[model samples]
Target: MAAEDPSVSGVSGRYATALFELARDERSIDAVKADLDQFEAMLADSADLKRLVRSPVFSADTQLKALAAVLEQAGITGISANFLKVVTANRRLFAVTGVIRAFRALVAKFKGEATADVTVAETLSDKNLDVLKAALKSVTGKDVALNVKVDRSIIGGLVVKLGSRMVDSSLRTKLNSIKHAMKEAG
Candidate 1:
C-alpha cells in the first residue's frame, strides 16, 4: 500500500519492494508469498536450479526460457510469475532468493509480525518448533515467524536472531568461550 522506502537500497531490496507493492495492489500478496516459498524450496532442493540462478554463463534469454518453464511446472502464476520473469529479463535472477527474503520481510513488517532466524544443531520437531515460536511470540509481543536452519556444527543448543538482536547459546560458542577463558587464566 505504501511506496517502497528509498532507504531500502540494493538491487534485491529495490526489486523486492517493487514486487511487493505490485502484489499488494493486485491483492495477490498471499499467493505471491506462497509462490516465492515454493520457489525458494526448489532452489534449496535442486543443485541444478541453484546453479542456473547463480551461474553467469547463461544468457538472459536462456534464463528467461528455463525459468518460465520451471515456474509453469511448479504452478506458479499471476503476479509472482510475472515478477520473476521480469527479474530474469533484467539479468537479476542470481538475486532472486535475496529478493524473496526482502519481500517476505516487508510482508511481515506490514502484517505487524516478527521473524526470527533460528539455527539449531538438529532439525526441530513440529512440537518443539511450535513451542519455540510461542516463546518468541511472547518475547516480541508479535506473531513470530521462524526461519529455521539446522547446523550440526553447533553440536547442541540454539542460536536465535531476532531483528538486530542475536542470542548465541550454541555448544560451540560456549566451548570457544571456555577455551578462551582457560587460555587467559593460563
Candidate 2:
C-alpha cells in the first residue's frame, strides 16, 4: 500500500483539500469523515440520490433543497452539512464523490497511512481479510487501510492497487497470458 500524492490539483482535489484543511483546523476530521462516508453510502444505495447529485436537470436551488432534506434525514450536520450546501449552491454536487475520495486520500497521507484498493473475485472471509491486511502492512511498512471490492469478472484471485503500483493476480489475467502464449507457440 502507498499513499496518494497530497498535491492533487484538479477541481475536486482543490475542494477536497479545502474541506480537509477545514476539518483538521476545526478538530472535526473524524466527524466530517463519518458524515461523508454516510452520505457516500446513501448515494450508493439510492438511485434518486445519485440522480439528484449527478443530473444537471435540477437547478441549484432544487438540488440544495433536496440535499438539505436528505442530509437532515441522514443526521448530517455541523461543518459537513454546511460544506455540502455550499457545494450544491456552487453547482458542484456532481463531483461530491470524487471530492470525498480525494479528501480521504489526503487524510490518509496526513496520517502516514496507505490505502490499498483490493479487488477480489468474491467477498473474503474475515480471517482472509485480516491476513491480507497484515501482508499489505508488512509491504508498506505503514498502517494500510483496505478498500475491498468484489468483481466476479476476475474469475478468481485478487488484484491490489496501491497508489502508482498494481499487482494483478486475477485468474482472468493468467488465462489470457496462457492463451497468448499458445498463439505465439503455434
Candidate 3:
C-alpha cells in the first residue's frame, strides 16, 4: 500500500512502513501515533528543533543528546522514542517530517479513515472542527481525520484536499475569479 502512495515512497516511506509494522506488532499504534504527532507539532512550533532536524551541521551525537532531552521533556517513550533515536542515529532526521506524514497515512489506511488536509484563514474552534469532520465523514463514508493549517493568505473561508480532489473556497480565490471574469468581459 505504501508503494501505491506517491507521498509515501522512497526513504521516508521505508522508515514509516517499518515503524508502522513495529507499532502494529506491539499493539501500540495509537500511542506511537500520538507521540509522533506531538513531535511533529514541536518541529512546526520550534525553529531550533527544526534546525536540529534539518541541518547537516549537527553531529549525530549532538542531535541524539538534544533529541533525548526533548523527547524526555515531552514525555515520549517506548517505540516512538526508539524509532526516532534510530532514525537520528542513521542520520535520516532531515526526513523525519515526511516519515511522520507517511506513518499517519499508513495509520489512516489501517483504521479505514480518510485524511483531509484543510487550510483555513484562521484557527478553527473545536465546534467548527467537529462540524467539518462530520461533513467530511458524511461525504467519504469513513471516519475523517483533518490536518488543519492556518494560512492568513487565504483571507477567509477554507480549502480542503481529500486524496486527489481539492475544493478551494477561500475569499482570495473567489476574488481572483471575479477579477478574471471582469477582465474577460472588457
Instruction: Give me the candidate number with maximum lDDT.
Output: 3
Error of 1 at 110 (Å): 0.8
CA lDDT for candidate 3: 0.96
The lDDT per prediction is: 0.89, 0.90, 0.96
Residue 180 error for model 1, in Å?
A: 1.6
Off by over 4 Å in 3: none
Residue-wise lDDT of candidate 1 within 1-186, one digit each (tens)?
Answer: 224533245888889889988888888888899999999999988999999999999999999999999999999998889999999999999999889878888888888889888999999999999999899988999998788888999999999999889999999999999999999999
- TM-score of each model, in listed order: 0.91, 0.89, 0.96
Ranking by TM-score: 3, 1, 2
Write one digit per residue (lDDT tens) for candidate 2, span 115-180.
889999998999999999899999999988777788999999999999889999999999999999
Instruction: Compare candidates 2 and 3 on lDDT and give the better one.
Output: 3
TM-score of 2: 0.89
* Model 2 poorest 10 in a row by lDDT: 1-10
Worst 10 residues of 1 by lDDT: 1-10
Tens digits of per-residue lDDT for model 3, 1-186: 779878788999999999999999999999999999999999989999999999999999999999999999999999999999999999999999999999999999999999999999999999999999999999999999888888999999999999999999999999999999999999
Which one is best on TM-score?
A: 3
